[model samples]
Target: IMVLLVLIFHLLFSCSHSLQYFYTAVTRGINFPELTAVGMIDGEKFLYYDGNTRQAIPKVDWIKNNVKPDYWTSQTQIIRGSEDRYKASLVTAMQRFNQSGGYYHPFQWMYGCELDGETGATDGYSQFGYDGADFLYLELRSTSYVAPVQQALITKQEWDVAEAERRKHYLTKECIYWLKKYVYYGKSILDRKVPPQVSLLQRDPSSPVVCHATGFYPDNVKISWQKDGQELHEDVDVGETLPNHDGTFQKRAELKVTPDVWKKNQFTCVVEHKSGDPIHMILTEEKIRTNSAGIIVGLVVAALVLIAVVVGVVMVVKR
Candidate 1:
C-alpha cells in the first residue's frame, strides 16, 4: 500500500509541473523580440500586456464598468495635434540608424507586466537591446527595490536626479502598482527524482553517429561521445536539453564521422543522470547488424530440407 501510494504521488507531481509549464507557455508565451514585432510603416515598436491573469495571449477588457475613453482621448489628442512632427521624427530616426544595416539598431522595445498566483511575488521591468549593450532598462522589484538604466548612458549625478524623480511619479504610481501583482505566479512544482531513458545509435554508413537521451525530469543532464577513451571535441554537435511531450525532457548529441573512422576506432556514448552513475553505451556497426536477412532465410531453408528427409525415412520404416 505504501509503495502504491508513493507511485501515485510521483505521477501526480509530474503531471502538475507539466501542466504549470504548459499553462505558462500557452498563456504568457516566451518573449522573442525579433519575432513578435509590430511593424510600423515609419517606425518599429511592439507592445506586451501581462493582463489581469496569466495567459499566452493578451486580453482586451474595456467594458462599460472599466471604460475610460476620456483619459485615453486626452492623451491621444496631444499626439494627434502633432502627428506630422512625430512622423517626421520617426522617419529621421530610422534613416539615421540605417534600417538597411545595423549601425545603431534598436533591436527591440518592450513594455511588460507579469502576475504571479502562488508566491505573490510581483515585479515588472522594461528592458531594451542586447544585455545592456547601449540599451535602456528599468526594473521595479518591490517598494524598496528599483533599478535604473543598466548602461552608463549619463553621469551618475544626472542619473541620480532622474531616478529620484521617477520613483515619485512613475514607480509609485497606481499603473505600476497594479502590474507588480503579476510575476508568473504559481505554487512552484518541484520534480527532482526522475531518470532519463538513453539510447545510442548510428545512422547510415557515412552519416553521423547520434546519442539520444530522453524521458527524464529536471532538465539538467550531460551527454558525451568518446572514442578510444578520449572525448570528442570537434565534429560533435550537442543540442540543448528540451522538454518532452510527457512533461519529461530530452537531449541529443551527434558525432560526424566517415565509415572508415568509425570502423577503425570504438566510439562510446556516456550519459550522466542526476540520480545514478554515468551510463556507458558503445557504437559499433558489427554489433548492430550481426547477420544479414538473406543469411537467416538460408538457414531456415536448410533446416526444412533435413526435416523432410527424416520424415520420408520414418514413413518407409513404418510401411
Candidate 2:
C-alpha cells in the first residue's frame, strides 16, 4: 500500500508545476475527524484544514508570510460549508450502499491542475474514491462524470452537464490562476536547489547494500547502481522519494550482490539531482557499517563502562 502511494505521488508530481487539493471524509465508526482538506503545490503541502481545527492553516513559511489572514478566513468558511455537505453526502452514500450501523466508510475527493514549464501545456483532473476504491471521475473532454462503481451510478446520473462544465472551468482556469499566484509567492523556496547527502548502508553482510540519499530539495532524483562503471538494471530495487521532516526529500536504491562479486568488480551508486553534478559513491567494505561490527563495537563500549563503574566503586571504598 505504501509503495502504491509513493508511485502515485511520483506520477502526479512528475510535472514542473502542479496544484492539487484533497478532501477526505469518514463515517462515525472511525476515531478521526469528520472531514479534512489539504492543498499542495508541486507535491509540497502548503495549506491544511480539518474538522477538528475548523481553521485553515498554512503549512509552509512562504504561505504564512505571503498570504493574508483574510484569505485563510475565507477559506475556513468555504471549507466549513464543504465539511457539512460532505458529511451529508457520506450519510447518503451509506444508504446508497445499504450499509447499516457500526461500519467504517471513507470518502475522498481530489482535484488538481498541472502546468508544463517548457511547453506551456496544462492538464486537469477531478476524481472521487469510496472505501479506498475509485467511485467516480470527471471526463473533461465529454464534460460528463464516469461512475466506476455501481453505488456511484445514481450520483452520476443526478449530476447534470452544467455542473460538469462548472467543475471543468474551475479546474482548468481558476485552479491554474491560483497555482501561478502561489508559485510567484513561493519562488524563493521552490526555485532554490539543495544537493543530497549520499551514503551506502547495509544491515548485515548478507543483506543488500542500500544507497541512501537524503536532504535534497525538489523530489525528482535518480539513483542507480553500476557494476564496473556500467549500469546494472537487474538485482536492483529503486525505492520512491520520500519527504524528510525538514521538507527535504530522501530516496534509496538497493543493489543485491554477493561479497565475492562486489569484491571483484567496482560497485558504485550514482545519484543525479538538479542541484549540481551527479554524485558517485564507490561501494567498499570499510564504507558500510554492518550489524556484526556494530554489535562488537557496542560490546566493547559496554565493557569499558563496566570497568569504569568497578574502578569508581573501588575508589569510593578507598576514600
lDDT of 2 by residue, 1-319 (tens): 9999766545443447888887877777567677888887876888888788899999999999987899999999999977888888878877888887687677777788988765568889888776667778888888899897899888888774777989999988999888877887887777668899987877788878888887888888999999988999999999756556576777889898888889899999999998999999999998885654454334335534432221111111100
User: Candidate 1 residues 1-110, lDDT tens each?
Assistant: 99997665454333212110000001112231112221110010111212222112211221112435564355344434443443343344344444443232223333
Query: In model 2, which regions exceed 4 Å deviation?
Result: 1-15, 95-98, 101-103, 291-319
Candidate 2 worst ten-residue window by lDDT = 310-319
Residue 196's lDDT in candidate 1 = 78
Model 2's TM-score against the true structure: 0.79
C-alpha lDDT of candidate 2 relative to the true structure: 0.77
Per-residue lDDT, model 2, residue 155, is 81
Q: Count the backbone clashes (under 3 Å) in each candidate.
A: 12, 0
> Which model scores highest in lDDT?
2
